[model samples]
Target: MIKNMKWLLLVSLTFVACNNDDSDTPAEVPVVAGSAVFTKYIALGDSFAAGYSDGALFAKGQSNSYANILSQQFAAAGGGAFTTPLMLDNIGGFSSGGLQVPKFPTRLTFIGATSSPANVPGVSATPITTHLTGTFSNLGVPGAKSFHLIAPGYGNLAGVFATPATANPYFARFASSATTSVLADAVAQTPTFFSLFIGGNDVLGYATNGGVPTSQDPVLGDDITPTATFNFAYNTLVTTLTANGAKGVVANLPYITTLPHFTTVPYNPLTAKSIGKNNDAVGLATIKLLNAQLYGPLKQALTALGAGDRINLLSETSTSPLLIKDETLPNLGAQLAAIFAPTLGAQTAGAYGAIFGQARQAKTTDLILLTTKDAIGTAPTAANSGLGIAPAFPLNAFGISFPLQDKHVLIPTEIAEIKTATDAYNVIIAAAAEAKGLAFVDTRSVLAQLSNGGFRFGNFTMTSSYAVGGAFSLDGVHPSARGYGLIANIFIDAINAKYGSTLRHVDLALYPIQYPLTIQ
Candidate 1:
């Protein structure tokens, strides 16, 4: 009770910084539009533009998206109304195609000091089957890649039921036509000024899935779009948007590998408290047992195979890194089986060799994905069941007794792959912005700064830390409402710098660090 109370107090203190000035009277500030016109503003991009936070997009999240915030500021400088395809309720996610899982799940909420954000506890009311009328100024669709913007039938309702499900559920709800593309719908609006912050989802999908290969994306739209594919798609969209003399601001993609989704879960999380769940004695005993039965034999076998440094003895007083499967590592299973077969039977020995052959303790360069944190100490039966992978002695603790699978962690090689792709993507974005003469917002460097240390907003500094950090929501991927406000200011800064406009910055302090347990 005391801990929850303290966290609640801290939450209040962290979000709302006291200015000490209670005066109601406000000072009038002068503003100017300079050379840019804001009469029909349109926002086009992915989830960030639509204001997705806490793992889902809800009513309040859309209201506070950077696009909407920027639109409101644009309104002050002669911009028109910025309408959004608002969801039906505060709880996000929606029922689509009668899928059992309801397509997307409900939005996440923080209740005091929980280990992770919990669902808001209800079914999402927005149904993809039901269509929303009206031409909205905000044409941002979640889960959209660069190529998806120009791909026709991206909004087709029938595509949602196709074998691969070609259409996006978010777009299927509000698309102007069954065959209209996201860019086509935006082009129809004919905006005088616009904002495009896309191409992150191209890399985001693969990065979030722990560098899953582009070919096998179990999660649809989770594959990394090829560099050439992204280059052509981005250029095409920019060219079409600017073809009609529409001036806009374009934000570049960030290195998503540094986001909280990839960084929050430390490589070494096996501490005394975590291992035993607040019991030091039991944890020490378990550690001893694991060392004697697992580590000792495994280390001996690996060292004999010229890989002694792969496994290390656990220290009772220190933290231990989890054993993870690195696909890039050379398989030593056959060699390991021969060595372990002396004491253990051939079948059991072979199982151990097969599981740990390419496995090693996670290093600093390796990233333990945020979603994989909870599955650390649990048994891996449900996933690996019937695969003939389990050892004979019930040594099935994930990341402890058994190595975590490829989906659970991103090794150095995978990290390099994502970074390389992001670097190439950024070059294309910068080149497009220059060639088109559009205002450019370097979101890559901005997010990098946020990850390295923290981003300063007045007296408070917001880090990208999960759950508690003001910059990111519980999901660890999308930014919080306050983070979106900071992003809005970033766009305004670029717009002002490029076009000599004097757009007013939104008050970052006014935005909440995160939505409360219930938005309604």
Candidate 2:
């Protein structure tokens, strides 16, 4: 800016000279450890700590993790070598050890020309069975919750296959022993200073799975950890970490539902062009067929049953909302069946009742998951077509003719549940940090700012708009490497304020937003 101003006006040259002249630049603030000890430091948390980006936890991503980023800054102080239990290759998920795809899926790559992201055609090279031989400073298990950090057998290799998955594979790969917990290993290092960032996975699961309350994911369990449970686990961690007089920092949980994963897909994305794949004429025909065969009759029957608000007629000019299953709504399938049975046969009426009972058109307040974008106009398979609708009705289309499943959309009721839990968790986290006198990071404010108009970082403005937003990766859930750098800066600021440390924030411009399609 100064250079440009100087060029624009000859009078500004004197001002620029007064400000510059190499030696005139302010002397560098000598980095200091202050009262905080950095000789032995540890980082404990979930994926953000591990630097999971583009939907996978590869070695490069791990290296750029906030923990590692902080360590780099710490190295300028008296901090010692900070080790990471890094993946063997750039392929983020476990590629080899008998792991399966979509579960241990590979990272995503953005195609610039198309402005879209696609899965890297293979699995990660690092397998779950590949155990490390050293203790790591980065104990950021990608899917770990608060309680999981204190749970025994969380790193047991054999337990990874158990129902509900008793162990986290990411931790199992580097845990000290089968019986060791994440805290046990960290405490073993006797860290003089640390950073605690748990509790995200505790609620993220419930939010990401469309606020379904509980998840049956093989790894994270995905259940919204009860407030009491979160409090207990949080205190236990803080109590244990500070027991040895280790001064540390902790972050409060944010309302993670605001992430691109839940916010990107619009509730009303069903348009003629989308339905017809850009062929507006064909799309109009499909829309007409869907309305004539399905939506029109459903609206009439639902209206007669006092549930008219559930279905809205499709239109040709404007975007139409998606059909979603909202379990909170009163099941009106029986009522619909009774209304339709007179015109349609009993068998067909029964199918209609079972299908539309808990279904309703998605509203603006609702959030359609990013993963569901591909499934919008696609047809559901036989197994998913449990509604048992006959061939005569429009039963093939998902999110259109057929209502989306509970896992694909988050309704207002579910959003309320998540907010309640997040607020409760934040309270517990704040209390714990205050009681421990630890540096507190209001991560909620950070993410909220990004979701809202975005906060400035030097010359660039970063937002949470998924791939293009520069803050988040293609997955829409995790942040890009540059985002991690920003987080590292936040941590530095909190530490500097609380501990009187002179730690310098990393320059975010050096970080890359996304990796190449072919990771070497």
Q: All candidates' lDDT scores? A: 0.85, 0.87
lDDT at residue 257 of model 2 (Cα atoms): 85
For this target, which candidate reaches the highest TM-score against the unseen true structure?
2
* Clash count for each candidate, listed in order shown: 0, 1
Clashing pairs in 1: none
Q: Candidate 1, which segments miss by more than 4 Å at Cα?
A: 1-29, 96-100, 214-219, 385-394
Task: Estimate the Cα RMSD of every predicted model relative to the unseen true structure.
Answer: 10.3, 5.4
Q: Highest lDDT, which number?
A: 2
- Tens-place lDDT digits, model 1, residues 1-520: 9999999999888656554364345756567777788999999999999999998888999999999999999988899988999998887888655431455888888767875678887777788677888999998889888888888888888887776788887888899999899999998988889899998888777877777754422127577788999999999999999998988999988888888999988999897777787899988888988899899999998999999889998778999999888889899999999998988889878887888889899999899999998889877774462245444444777888788888888888888888888889989999999999999999888888887788776888888878667888889999999999999999999999988889999888999998987776
* Residue 417, model 2: Cα distance from true site in angstroms: 1.1
lDDT of 1 at 418: 84
RMSD of 2: 5.4
Look at candidate 2 and give me any clashing residue pairs: 95-124
Residues 264-331, candidate 2: write the lDDT tens digits: 88988888998888899999999998788788999888888888999989988999999888889999
Question: Which residue ranges in model 2 land beyond 4 Å of their true spot?
Answer: 1-23, 97-102, 111-115, 213-220, 386-393
